[model samples]
Target: MDGSVMQDTDLAVLLHQVQHRTASPEIVSSDCSASPPAVLPKRVAAAFASTDGDSDSGGDSLLRPKKLRKPTDSGGDSLLRPKKLRKPTYAARKEEIAALLEEHRLLQARLELLRQNVGIPTSYDHDTLEAAQRQQRAMEEALRLQQFALGNTQSLFSKHMNALEPNPLKTYIHLTTDAVERRNTLLSIRREKLHRCYQFVHERLHHIPETSPYHVEERYVNAKGDRIISRFERLLFPGVQDVKQVFNALLFYLTNMEISISETLGHVTVRDDIDAVETRVSNHRVVSSTSYGIELELNAVHCYEYYEKFEEMGGQEFAME
Candidate 1:
């Protein structure tokens, strides 16, 4: 019986030591130096501890699966959450946009105003307007070129005519002895004829009645101190007809006189030369004439035809009245 009691006490002591080692696992690690302490998983340790009748309900709290506590707004743990992007707003650029819109409005208004002033219809689009502007520029350029060409032609023609004109003051010293006397006689005859023609024109002018169609104006004097007729006007009368008739009569008379003189001199070549010079000079004068009222001038082609007809007619007098 005593032996049985000793065995029971020994069993009780072994049971107490196992309970102490399980409660404090660090003591088992320190006391045992020969082998490494075996680690028990939290689940296994909690299961073992739960079997102990003396273990408190709260003893397994450390091993229980932890309930995750959500991070608070004030905590640094909130930094782990993904940030949500805020939508963009145009409020910051509102002033800039408004200013740009205002400027665009003003520019549109200015463009419209410019179009109106330039005579461009509002119905025209940008492309049409640009085309019109280009056309206008082209027309202006063409007109400028035309004027330039006209100016150049006038100057060149004037120089050519001046060069061709014979100087009345020049002496014919280079003429052969045989032709000199004949040439002097022809020149004297031409001078006398010209003086007689001038006297005839002067007499006609002086004889014009107060009620006559022709009204002559003496405004200046010529280089030879002779009075120059500046203008001729027709009297306002019931019977006053076309002034062209009077001009035709005078022209016919002068042309006939000139032909008569040339025939008397027996110089057909000189007459032909004089006709050509007169035609050229008259044509140039016609082109340059800016006189008002009666259009007495004829173009070069017409002047040529007029001289041909005059020659064909044998210098017949054209009746004025």
Candidate 2:
């Protein structure tokens, strides 16, 4: 009878300990039952309840399923989430620019071919057309000023040339079909040469490894073993600027020369129909493949030399049309 009473006392103590351990604020709400908690097995709860107060005694080692951590929790689980992929802005821009540059080159080639075949080139870009028109206007103004200055000098050549056009409209009406055809032929030749020179420059730029920093780094070496960041910038930036200046000068002078020569021929024609024939005879200028004569007359001294250098480098020779 005594042993049974002691056993009953031990069972009650075990139940009390388990109830105390499992009584978290979450589990001990008013709605929770006073009976064994639903999460724990009845046998496991009974076992833990019989243990001493010391946590190291392992009475709480029941294998209840672990609750998954919330995403907001500061735990290693958050680190395992996949990060979003970033956009490749640099690569995307590089490709876009390369495509645009290629398109520009193709358009330039097509324009040249059209100019050669039909004597008229098509331009799609507004800025390009505007720039060409502006350049032509400036050339015309310069030619007019030059004629004015020449007239003031009262030179024999200038006097006779001006004497031809007593009535500008009548002179225009008297222009023979042959003279018109000759002028058109000369203009076509000049346009073809200028276009070829421009194409040479453009293709030269595209071929130059030094123009790009990435290409420069690959091929060029600094023998002094110094750092090359500054050198690379110097090689590409100022060099490109110089090339651009050369290109602009070429276009300006070539256009000016073409306009001036054509204007002179027109004035000479107005003076006497036979003067065009005489001028052609005295000049004895057959349309030579060499642009040296025209280039020299305009004092674009470096133009042909620069073209030759690029031609050699690119292994491309310009053929006269």
lDDT at 65, model 1 = 42
Give the distance in Å from residue 236's predicted Cα in candidate 2 to where it truly belongs: 72
Worst 10 residues of 2 by lDDT: 279-288
Highest-scoring model, lDDT: 1
Q: What are the Cα lDDT values of the candidates? A: 0.49, 0.47
lDDT of 2: 0.47
What stretches of model 1 exceed 4 Å from their correct place? 1-58, 63-124, 165-321
lDDT of 1 by residue, 160-255 (tens): 634542423222333234545534444444444444543545555765674667764535444456543445455543554644455565556444
Q: Write the per-residue lDDT of candidate 2 for residues 1-321, one digit (tens) a residue.
A: 999797767666766665574545455455332445556556545555444243335443342234687666555555876778877999889999999999999998887777768866455445688998999999999999999988877566434533443322221212234756655554434444545655644553565564455422222224444322311121334544445355556545443444454465532111112222222211111221223333222111111222323454474422211
RMSD of each: 18.1, 33.6
How far is 136's C-alpha from truth in model 1 (Å)?
1.9
Q: Find the 10 residues in a row with the least total lDDT in model 1.
A: 280-289
Q: Clashes in model 2: which pairs?
A: 164-271
List ranges where model 2 is wrong by over 4 Å.
Answer: 1-9, 12-92, 114-321
